[model samples]
Target: MARRAIDEGYKVRCLVRSSKKAAFLKEWGAELVPGNLRYPDTLAEALVGVTQVIDASTSRPTDSLSIKQVDWDGKVALIQAAKAAGVERFIFFSILDADKYPEVPLMEIKRCTELFLAESGLNYTILRLAGFMQGLIGQYGIPILESQPVWVTGNSSPIAYMDTQDIAKFAIRALSVPETQNQTFPVVGTRAWSAEEIINLCERLSGKDARVTRMPITLLRAVRGLMRFFQWGWNVADRLAFTEVLASGKELNASMDEVYTIFGLDPQQTTTLESYLQEYFSRIMKKLKELDYQKNKNKNKKEKPKKTPFKQSSKANSQ
Candidate 1:
């Protein structure tokens, strides 16, 4: 996102919790302000003199803070700060159909945040995303490439996962598009893909068979219930709740025609799941082959015997 903003001639300011971890942002010419969503006191300083705010922060399942603390409480604080700062534009990224699954903790929080942003009176653009293709790298791509077990539930929904780069294009373009103000849009890929379809694609591209592991939804519910007892497992339980929604056989997708028309994006230019996976497998396999060739070349050099030195010149003269 910072790259897109910078390329569009906008000065990018990133509110980060760690300056050391966000060093790359500085390299990209983004001014980094040390702040965390968990701390409201740091927000005012970060928001000062900032005309626009692009919030993509979310609490992970393994974070020390609970989802309510970061997503709800912290976001509320940030919105208030942005409003007080007289910010011109605010862009927020959320999950698709967040309002439909209030039973899911993450979805509920995201929906609440969307409402809060709308009523804040600040010009905002809410982008509801189906999923990210980057996530599939760990979930299916790497597992299949390494011949590891690819876990899938009894019934999983087909999700139209968009590339982060495409999502960023929409986000940055929203800053200048008048129609996007105070409006919500769903940004998805060209086509939706199911778990089985993704697994098959990865296997075909990588030339490796996947060890499929299917877990019944009933067992997943039981495990989620068990995890709810422990404080550390609460976030995991919440994530499992959303996973159950995906396994409910409901497709997670939306029509992108309106989005493309409003954002002035060509549907044909969007990346497809097949092309993305194909490029990934090709790059990875080429890298592996290069590494293997280098290893063998070094081994051959080590195994070759050294040539014996010739006799001294004095011995030849005496002869």
Candidate 2:
């Protein structure tokens, strides 16, 4: 987020839950303000004298409340507070299909937030981001199979994926000036791919055997349930679900023609799926090498058990 704002040439201020965690960002030139999204009063101090407010904190796996709490209630309070602070423009991160999939928690919450913003009468721009490309990195934890038959509910959606780096670059463009006011963009990549095609791409990039398999719609909930039993990464299935959306052969982006024209920003040039997956797999290999080395070292350093003075077997050995 700071990367995007800073690239916009905005003197960035970040409201963080912890100052220490933000140290790297502070060192990178972000001004740190302490606040929580849940508390609007705390935001007032940080937002004072600021002309624009961006609500960027969205969700994490550890969150106990639904996205509605984070995206609506928390966001609404902050919006109300920012308005009272006399702020003018509001920028928001949103999702594609927010109107279509109001059933999905993320989409449902984003719609609510959008409604609030519309009602708040604040000039705003909403970037309904393409499914974040960075999410692919998290899905790496999904168990790899030989000829890996990845299951999906829908395998025909034409996914328009976007790199976060590109999203950040574009966001910076929007923020550097005031071109994106009162506009909502459902942003995505220039191209779309099916889930099967995406899986094949990953296989080629990783040099791993895998295939995309379509799971019957009736079994999706059960599969999600079964996967939940194992302790694993939170984003694994979410990434797959997103991929499945595109694999269903449905196009996710509706505004690509005007995305650039509306924002008056050039389309971003950055890593593509091949480059992103290549680098991702390379990083995984590096981490696996480190783990293997550590495992070997521990295996070689087996310590002898300490002899107990009270144990008869140890006493006999000593004698």
Candidate 3:
């Protein structure tokens, strides 16, 4: 989103906890504003002359008081600051069903912030986004049993997945269009998917078998199992931590037909499941191929062991 805004020739000022980490954005000619949500003055200072605000901040797991700091108190501070500075429209990036998904502690913060925006009288346009496919790319660090499996709790709900790029495009549109004023857009793609279905698709694409183990929430003990959190790649904490909200219980099958009607262009691109897997998990496949080849080389060496010198000599003499 920062890249898109900067590309659109807007004098984009990005607020990051550390300006040093924003080298990529700065390279794209965006002005970096060093600020932390925990500090109201710093947040207020960052929005002094800013016209629009797009919040993509994450609450660190170690911050026990982050709910009050960033999600609730920090957002309130930003809203108040934006209003005081006479900012035009507050473009908030929020999560879907943030209020409902309290099991994930972070979303609860988003819920409170959403309420604060609506009541802030700042002509806020909140974009509640679904999960991002990009999160699965990095060292997934999944359990390496005989079959790599992701642990899931409860029903394999049909979750609506949206590309981060698409969401950014919508966000850029919101920046220029006046019709988007004071509207809350629940943004999603054309299709919905379940965890098991996604796994199946990946396995099929890779021509390999993937095992999925479904565990009920009741089975997880906070003290024993969840505390150490050995597995995070596809664990509950991982899903909750990476996602802005969970689409697990709800069948999020509704298309952004409404958004298309309003925007006049179908935001939905023709990215198939195959394309998604290739784009996201290509590295995994490459690594697996390397491992397989190495294993084959070792097996061949073992199967054709070096001929015993004495035994071969005796056999040749006998012959």
Candidate 4:
């Protein structure tokens, strides 16, 4: 998002806890503001001259802060701060079907945040995303490439995963589109893909069979129940609650015609799952082959004995 905004001549200011860690953003022509969502006091400085606020922040399951603190309280504080700072455009990224799964901690917080943003009276665009194709790298791509167990729930549902780049396009475009203001849109992919289909695609691309491990949804529920008992495991349990949605057998997808029309995006140009994975595997394989070639070249150079210089030895010189 920062990259796109910078390319479009928008001066992007990113809120970061550590400017040193976010130095790459500076290289991309983005100003790094030292701030954190959890720390609302610092937000005022960050938003001092900011016109648009694109919030894609979310609490991870392994985050030290609780979801309520980061997702709910932090977001509420940011919205209030943005309103106070006279920020013109606010774009928020949310999970698809968040309102329907109030039981899930993250989804509940997202739904609540959506309502809060709507009532905050600030011009906001809420983008509910199905899933990110980037996530598939950790979940499926790496595991398949490494011949590790690719875990999947027995009732894993299909998810329309969009490339983060494509998602960024929609987000940045929303800042200029008047029709997007105060409107909620489902930003999804051209098609939804199931776990089995993804596994097959990975196998086909990588030319390696996956070590598939399918756990029953009932077992997942039981494990989630077990994890809920411990304080440290509460966040993990909350994350596991999402399995219920997959167990429901409802596909996480929506028609993107309206989004494309409004955003001036071409559906034909949208990145498809097949093409995305194909490119990923192709790049990875090319790198691996290059590394292998370099390794072999070095090995041969070391193993091949250096040709002894044709020396004028006493015996040879005599001959």
How close is each model in CA RMSD to the real structure? Answer: 4.1, 8.3, 6.0, 3.2
> Compared with the true structure, what per-residue lDDT tens digits does model 3 show for residues 177-287?
888899988877557777767776666655666665766544443332464355432234433442323325676545577786775556546354457667655776688
Candidate 4: segments with Cα more than 4 A from true spot? 305-319
Q: Tens-digit lDDT track for model 1 on 221-289?
A: 998999999988887788789876679788899998988999998999898999988999999999999
Predicted candidate 2 versus true structure: per-residue lDDT over 134-221, tens digit per residue? 7755443243423445655554665677787777765666654566877777778767655666777777666677655566754654
lDDT for 295 in candidate 4 is 100
Judged by whole-model lDDT over C-alpha atoms, candidate 2 comes out at: 0.69
Look at candidate 4 and give me any clashing residue pairs.
none
**Worst 10-residue lDDT window, candidate 3:** 137-146
**Residue 170 Cα positional deviation in candidate 3, in Å, after optimal superposition:** 0.7
Query: Which tens-of-lDDT digit does each residue in 1-319 have in candidate 4?
Result: 9899999999889998888889999999998888888888999988998899999887886678878888999999999999999999899988899989988888888999999999998999999998899999999999999999999987778999999999999999998889998999999998999999999999999999999998898998899899989998887788788888766778999988888999888888889999999999999999999999999999988896555546546558879
Model 1 ranges with Cα > 4 A deviation = 305-319
TM-score of 2: 0.75
lDDT accuracy of residue 278 in candidate 3: 71
Worst 10 residues of 2 by lDDT: 233-242
How much is the lDDT of residue 169 in candidate 4? 93
Candidate numbers sorted by lDDT from highest down: 1, 4, 2, 3
Question: Candidate 3 at 15: error in angstroms?
Answer: 0.9
